[model samples]
Target: MRSVYMQSLAYVDANRIYSRIMELGEIGRTKQSGVQRLALSKEDKEAQILVTKWMEEAGLTVSHDHFGNLIGRKEGEKPHLPIVMIGSHIDSVRNGGKFDGIIGVLGGIEIAQFIYSNNISHAHTLEVIAFCEEEGSQFNDGLFGSRGMVGKATEEDFQKKNDQQVTRFDALKNFGSEIDPARYKESVRKEEEIKIYLEMHIEQGPYLDVNSHPVGIVNGIAGLSWYTIMIEGTPGHAGTVPMNLRNDPMIGAAKVIQEINEICSSQPDQQTVGTVGIIQAFPGGSNIIPNAVQFSLDLRDINLTRKNRIFAEIEERLQAICQENGLSYTIKTNIELDPVACSEEIIDVFTSIGKKLDMDIPIMVSGAGHDAMLMSEITDIGMIFVRCKKGISHQPEESATKEDIAMGTEIMLQAVLQYI
Candidate 1:
């Protein structure tokens, strides 16, 4: 342990890691000065190559899986030891910030560099992976890479195409690689293979930055449910449609949206949130009474019971509104993802390291989902939270200071030492 600590102190240069992140930030900037490296795009593939180069320079054995996730492994004395995995996604939403996902990947690489330089030997290996996609901005699929690795993805999901009509399998081929039809199941990491997993990411919200806390120890990830609500009614000329004589789906939709918001507001707060992200009207013209309206509802909560209750309330309210208005409607839940809790054992290690470093690490729940959520299913998982400037993400303006990132990186290194 003394040797490991000395190894970390000797080779871990926070500023160097910071420079690398800033440099990568320049390579993938969008025209708007945001980021645009969505899943399988030319930019995304190029970033993979760049990081793989760094992996080689760090002296780790590097390879990519059938899912396109890049893994860099540092072998320990015992080759068959269970690995301590650390990584996050490299893909971003349109105009996303730099630190959202890449921080974990880079931090892990830095740790591996330190281990190699100090000749630190351990029973467990350190594995750093760059998840292919976490943001579903370009493709309709999110966590595609992680899901494929864990064998959670179905054949139908692989068949689903992106905006370019490129299937997930074909998208990999476009990058000069092909998915083995038989090896899809081999992608999942068995429970015995991974001892633990840790990820470092920007808070992506204002809590830590506003509170003047330098870091956050995440407690659990929120569960989410999404549904598309379609309302059907008779379309008629606006001038001819009498107020009382017409069956108006638009009117019902408005009432339902209002009720949905109010119901969510009325619930006991446990980090529960609801949103209506998309709304569309058929024949959306000023002069025509809308005959059809489709909208999407997203409900999320850290506590599973609260999420289910809110979801049920919205469904009941929508049904009542449609029946009362005599309008035909349909509600389809596109996805209902379960919540994930972090490993208490791993969380304790993070907290202990933060104390030794004299960092004020607050405990918080991640409102947004992440690759860590998927990794948690197979391993004991932990996360390090760097403070974002304004607690904002998924935009060109999303920012985090260099100092905050450096602080998180050092803390992460300490945690790696303890884990190994």
Candidate 2:
């Protein structure tokens, strides 16, 4: 293929990128055409091997850090300059769509391939990374790989046990990785060694597609918190207990759920969102009143203070409801992630390139968490989002057209060139 330049960078091969995406999707192929390559699973290992091979074929040197982050590096004219890093994770949730994290990793490879094939020389070295586990589907600890790289991961973090009683340390050892808790800090890259970080991902929401835009330049990632609530009450026979006399926990739980919705809806900030996704009632039968109910609550906002304030309101209302319903409750927090803003300098690069390419690119906030969120701690970070069909993700139906993927890749390549 003849070299096509956008300013000074060569246009990425759309066909080559799409083909590699399909190839990676086939590794953990589910019956429904989804993926199940949970982190450190056999399938995840296979996918890593394949990606490593592709990186080598693209004329990049491949290496793995103590934290299991796979890195591929290409030397630049000035090896002393800080490296320009690009990448995303490859691990998938159970039966998740193929495009969630695959696009960014493969897209980075495509850029390296373009550079190598065209003999383009850059000033700073380039590194493409395939993060180990960003979905947290396995250990329920999201951003595990990037967390290690930024020196945010603790020994306690690795001690967490999954549902099967498998600790993260054991899982890594089982997956053929060498583990030394003492060396985790050594894996962290110094702030001065990284010039910038960029990741290209699917929007995972319908905003861009609905607005008829092909690209989304991310402005920030939302902060999120998860809680498990349990309500306890007395159980009685359905036939024997009168409706007015019975102490039903489910009733209190229902009231709490409704109040949660109200609090979130009444928030002046439109970016705040609340969800109650999981519910379980004890004595779940036609002839008994439920004595206990357990449910999960997810709260998110781009503003950390606003999100915490909303959560406080939820707790206050929930306490009142429990007292009125004669039920006792307990709440436990599972996860807490702070909001992160994207670098304005990198955002300008994307915006400038979008205008030159004649594409309508809008600056937007991301409601989802990514490796880029954790990477923000160590260096300047930016993101490019492609349109996904129906804005659906984490399921079998998650999708992005080849044309949109190609567009995102081109924008990412151009941004890298400009930055380098």
Please name the candidate that would achieve the greatest TM-score relative to the true structure.
1
RMSD of every candidate to native, in Å, equals 2.4, 2.8
TM-score of model number 2: 0.91
lDDT string, candidate 2, 365-400, tens digits? 999988998898889999999999999999989989
Candidate 1 per-residue lDDT over residues 194-217, each given as its tens digit:
888888898888999889988899
Per-candidate Cα lDDT values, in order, are 0.80, 0.88
Candidate 1 off by > 4 Å: 5-11, 237-240, 243-245, 283-291
- Runs in model 2 deviating more than 4 A are 1-10, 178-182, 234-247, 280-292
lDDT of candidate model 1 versus the reference? 0.80
Error of 2 at 202 (Å): 0.4
